[model samples]
Target: MEIYALFGTSGTGKSSSALELAYRMNIDAIIDDGILIYEGRKIAGTSAKYEKTKIQAVKRAIFHYEEHASEVKRILDQIQPSRILILGTSKRMIERIVEALQLSSPAEYIPIESIKPKQEIEAAQYVRQTMGKHVIPIPRVEVEKDFLQRLIASAQQIFSSKKEMIGETTVVHPPFTGGRIQIHPQVLRKIVLATCNDFAEVGQVLKTVFTFDDLPRLYVTLSLKLPYGRDIPTLMQDIQLALHKETSFCLNIAPASIDIQIAGLELITTE
Candidate 1:
């Protein structure tokens, strides 16, 4: 298999530009942050961004765990793509991943500087430093299943020069980053309740449950009081949309599921 490497320092926009580079080179797969991606889907391996410490995250990225390394290697062996792209902070880091995965050394090394301007790289660095956001070259839906839901924010879709859809990228803020801010569960619940209450059709938020497992999800049971002539389905749809938008905006994380069960409905009296 032909191997290509993209190298840059940490937070230099390497991950941000990886998909575009792979598309331009016509590469079939990408190995980045311990995940194997093909056609913008994560096929194998867990992301280092899920680790709780920087040291552990680094180890994961280089495939230090035997099981993790074996999993990715097995997939690569089975599929056997013609060409693959590897991303890393340095040439040595790329070499480590190749060795751990038992893949051949990269034949071409592309520097991040060649693809991104200095100002862009600086801006990426600033966001990484301040907001603690990391880019994963996979769609948000795929990421929501694999990653901790609290860490995932939004999906970014990239298009080619001809306006063809290339791939989707996810922005995440892993807990391993130092000085990163945390959103309290109670605060998040309150935001959800408030958002639900904002809708004229919603009477009260009965109960809210937040699950923080492999994927974070929210379950809300609420009562809605519609106008005598209002459509129930339409009002419920509006509530769902409003709840999703407000909750995602406030938490900067996507919930794997937002289940709004209407417990009861009351009639609004005309004045």
Candidate 2:
């Protein structure tokens, strides 16, 4: 089978990107943190996340146990998928998994930086370092089957609301990690307000609302001053992009939706 590898150092959001990357590339299965997932199903193998310690977790992730490797290998042999995506921290780690599973070398090597921007990756790493939460491309319910219910932190279905995007993702707290670091709504509001104030065109921020239900969704009610030659639509896009970029850089997140309400418009004056 042809293999594709998406690798980055720990906490760089490799797992966070896996599902969308797989969908984009049309990969048939995903092997992440020692779990074998095919067609949105956990076919075989246990997650290394279930381990109690980091050393043990590393061993499990690399399929150190003969049974772990054999079970996944046997299933692969039976199913014989044409293409598979492997998630790892490095090329060497991918090599170890391929050797463990008795599979050939990867036909493609995709680094995390190749797919993710530096700002986004740093934000993801910051989240990992601070919050200790990790993402798995598998669905929350399916992954939780091998995990205690308490370990399930949250989940988001992959990509867009568009129908043919068939994947679910789980955000988990591995047994080795500590507690979470939540960004309160007030903090988020301040950040949004600050971003708006930074723009010369914004006259006032009337109100701000930030929601974190399934994904981060932001709403801002504001009035703006019209610059000499700039249209409202272009300025709106600029505000949305700035908000998205600022949130991603500061909080390691991009909102699912950012709605900017223009309450009032006044023409700018140069005295």
Candidate 1 least-lDDT 10 residues:
146-155
- Candidate 2 regions exceeding 4 Å error are 151-153, 159-162, 179-271
lDDT of each: 0.84, 0.84
Clashes, model 2: 0
Displacement of residue 132 (Cα, Å) in model 2 is 1.2
Put down candidate 2 lDDT per residue, 1-271, tens digits, no spaces.
8999999999988887887888888888999998998977788998887789989889999999999999999999999988999999999999999999999999999999999987677667767776777887776668655465645554567654566546777777787876667778788888988898888889999999976543457899998887566788988899999999999888866777899999998887676
TM-score, every prediction: 0.64, 0.66
Candidate 1 local distance difference test against the native: 0.84
Please identify model 1 stretches exceeding 4 Å from their true place.
Answer: 144-148, 161-164, 180-271
Candidate 2 — what's its lDDT?
A: 0.84
